[model samples]
Target: MAQMTIAEALREALREEMIRDERVFCIGEDIGIRGGWGGAFTVTLGLEKVARERVIDTPISENGLFGVALGAAIMGLRPVADVQYGDFLFNAMDQVANHIAKIRYMSGGKIKVPLVMRAPVGATGRGAQHAQNLEATFLTIPGIKIVCPATAYDAKGLLKAAIRDDSPVLMFEHKLLYGSKGARSESGAVDASSDIPDEDYVVSIGKGIVRREGADVTIVGTLLMMHLALQAADRLAQEGISAEVIDPRSLVPFDWELLEESVRKTSRLVVVAEGPKTGGIGSEIAATVSERMMDYLTAPIQRVASPDIPVPFSPVMENFYRPDVDRICGAARKTIGD
Candidate 1:
């Protein structure tokens, strides 16, 4: 076993995937640059030296690059497309939410899009344009699968699974939880490193993991919110609140069974996310739990998320805007009416 940062683990996964599949290539801006930040976070640094042809750099056209990836995917090639920031996904909405996501259904299940889309999300003082957590926007999209891994172990495993899968997959990496180092390291970064297994393994795309087992309340979170939820669980434990922390790595095709199991035991649920409150992933989770596990829930479901406003540039407001340990704990208490 080896302790690896999120960036390192992801780079390792990309390297392995390319080696495992001759047709697996990467398309993104600055990823294969001579000395760039390696797709904005060093996740692809030094990759070009080994996989030069596979790690193809592109212009700053998200729509164009993603269109090319979709074309290659349809041609029986696995393309891992990278977006510098999660917010930029909007620029490629036509290619992503429209064409690529609809081709299989449009073709009556005769085609498969073995494409992996990677985007780094979370607030880091980049203001509204680059710091948005846009995962919620694609949750309702039918074809693409979403995976937001919080730990290095999950990053590697889920990424491998995404590459091998026969359908389109979206992987959202948290900027603050990447554990990136050197010039690409993030301020206020959390320790999300994990001891990755030496042998190959894959975390199933639709499964959720219980990071902390408890019985008082269940906290469901993704990306950096997952880390914060676990921290909140630790703090709430001191107050005699046993919070069960769950990392729903895969969003679409969500593991409702695992979450229902936790809600059944805890009899309380608090969904946390960094996205906006309204019509967001949290809203869907709360509604889903209310519909599926209403009888199991002893209290009204609560959601902790940012307001429906653009992300702030100021450090103070940005910190207040994103869901933190305090915010999650408060939501847990509110759900239980403590």
Candidate 2:
């Protein structure tokens, strides 16, 4: 076992998957260039040496690049299309929402879009154009699967699984949670690193893992916000507030059973997310919890999320824009007051 960051772990997964399957290849901008930033981060660095032809580099055309992946997927090739930024996903909306997601269903389940779109998300002082969390954008989509891995272990495991999955999958990686290093390192990075296994592993999509177990309240979060929830949980523990922290690694195929069971145990729920409050991921979780576990709730469900506004450019305002430990802890306290 070795300690690894999310970026290193994902690179390893891609390398392993490409070696295991000749059909697997990466298609994106700056992925294979020597001394270049690997697809906006270093996740694809040094991949060219492993599979020269498979490590493809493309022009700065998100729509065109994504379309090629869809075409390849239709022909039974697994292509990992990398978008430079999550916000740039808007450029390829038609390809993703219209084509890649609906190919299998439109073909009456005869086709499989075994394609993966990797995008780096979350605000890292890059202003609005590059910082948006796009998970909420695809929650309602029928065909595409969404996975957001917060830790190094899940990042590697989930990426491996996504490569093998037969449907279109969107992988949203958080900038701060990447634990990136060198020139591509983030200034205010969070250490979500973990000791990855020596053997091959795959974290099945649609399953949620409980990071911390408690009985007073259940706190749900994903990606960067998942780390925030764990921080809040620690503080809440200091105050004698037992809060359970859950990481819904796969957002679309949400682990409703895990959430429902945790909510039932705690009888209180507070969801934390980095995106805006309106139509945020918390909205769906809160709604589902109310629908399925309302009987177990002792108080109204609370949500700790950003305001319905653009992420601020200033670091202080950015911190204020997103949910923090104090906010989450307060929400938890409000949900289950002493």
Candidate 3:
């Protein structure tokens, strides 16, 4: 096993996938340029050398890129499409929500759009336009599968799974967790690197993993928030609180069984998400858990999330905008009547 960052692991996954399948290729803006930063944060940094012809660098048009990827997938070619920032996905909402998501269903199961769309999300002082946690936005779209991998191991495994999946997969990668080095490095980034195996492997989509086990409370988080939850768990431990942390790698096909089992054991729940609180991923998890596991819950489920406003550009304001370890700890304590 070799230690790797999320960015390096993702690049490896793309390289291996493209090598494994001739039909697999990558298309995006500034991805394969001679001196590019590898499509925003170094994920595709040196991939062109693997397959120059397959690593296509396109013009700065999100809609056109999605259209091209959609067409390629429809024709039986697997294209891994990506955007520099997840906010750019809004520019191609029609292509994603309408055509790319509905074509197979409209065709009565005969068509399989095996395409993977990767987008870097989360706030990192990029302001409102560039930094937005889009998991909630795409979660409403039925035809697409969503996965947010917070660790290097899960990132590599899930990316491989998404590339091979027959349905369109929307993968949300956190900017601060990319562990990009030097020029592409982020401010106040968290370490999400892991020791990766050389052998080929895939983490099944929709399966969640328990990051930590406890008997007091269950805390669920994804992407950057998952790291914060772990940090918050450490702090709560000092106060004699045992908090279980869960990372739902796949958002669309959520791992309800794993989540329910944790909630049953702890009888307390706190969902932490980086996006806005209103209609956020945390909201969905809390609502669903309440509806199905109300009997096991001892107290009302708590949610730690951002406000319903655009992410601020100012560093101080941005820090306040996203949920922090303090916020997560407070929410966890609240669930346990602290």
Candidate 4:
């Protein structure tokens, strides 16, 4: 096992995937440039040296990037497309939402799109344009799988799995949880490193992991919010709250079985998401749990998320804009009547 950050583990995953499969390649703006910030967060830094021919750089066009990847995937190439920011995905919605997402389904399952889309999300002083948590937007879109990795272990494993899967996978990485080092380090970065195994492995997509087991309430979160939910669980334990924390790493094919089991055991639920409260990921989870497990729930499902506004540029407002441990703890307490 090797201790590695999320960025290092992801870089290793890309390297291994490219080596394992001849058709696997990476395409993005500034990704193949020598000494660049590895597609913004250093995940692809130094990868051009490993497979220079496959590390294809493109113009600053999200539409063109997705178009190229969509065509490549249809032609039996596994393309890992990178977006410098999660918000840039809006620029390529036609290709992503229309072509890449529906080509296989529209073709009656005769075609496959083995494409992996990677983007870094969360507010980090990049303002509304560069820092949107896009999980909700893509989750609503059908025919695409979404995976959000909070730890280095899951980061490596999920990317490997997404590359191997024959479906278009949207992988969202939290900017603050990347654990980038040196010049690429992010401010207020969380310690998301893990002892990754050297052997080949993959975390199954559409599965959720229980971060902390409890009996009073189930707290569900993803990406950066998952880490904060764990911290809130620690604080809730001190007050005898017994908040169970769950990280639904894969959003599209959500692990409803694991979530149902937790909600049944806990009898209460609190969903924490980084995006706005209205029509957010948390809202979907809350609504689904209420619909399916209403008989087992002892209290109403609670959702803690940002307000219905664009991400603020100010660091102070950004901090207030995202969900924190205090907000998670408060939501958990409210769910369990603490």
* Each prediction's RMSD to truth: 0.9, 0.8, 0.7, 0.8
Report how far off residue 101 is in candidate 1 (Å).
0.3
Worst lDDT run of 10 residues, candidate 3, spans 35-44
Q: Write model 1 residue lDDT over 62-165, tens digit each, in one string.
A: 99999999999999999999999988899999999898899999999999999999999999988999898988889878999999999999999999999999
Show model 4 residue runs off by greater than 4 Å.
Answer: none
Instruction: Note the residue pairs that clash in candidate 2.
Output: none
Whole-model lDDT values for every prediction: 0.92, 0.92, 0.94, 0.92
The digit string of per-residue lDDT tens for model 4 on 45-82 reads 88887779999999999998999999999999999999
Please state the error at residue 314 of candidate 2 in Å.
Answer: 1.1
* Cα lDDT, model 4, residue 259: 97
lDDT of 1 at 288: 84
Residue 12 miss distance in model 1 (angstroms): 0.2
How big is the positional error of residue 178 in model 3, measured in Å on the Cα after superposition? 0.7
| Index of the highest-lDDT prediction | 3
Q: Please give, for residues 87-190, the per-residue lDDT of candidate 3 as tens digits.
A: 99999898999999999999999999999999999999889999999999888899999999999999999999999999999999999999999988998999
- Clash pairs, candidate 3, are none
* 2 or 4, greater by lDDT: 4
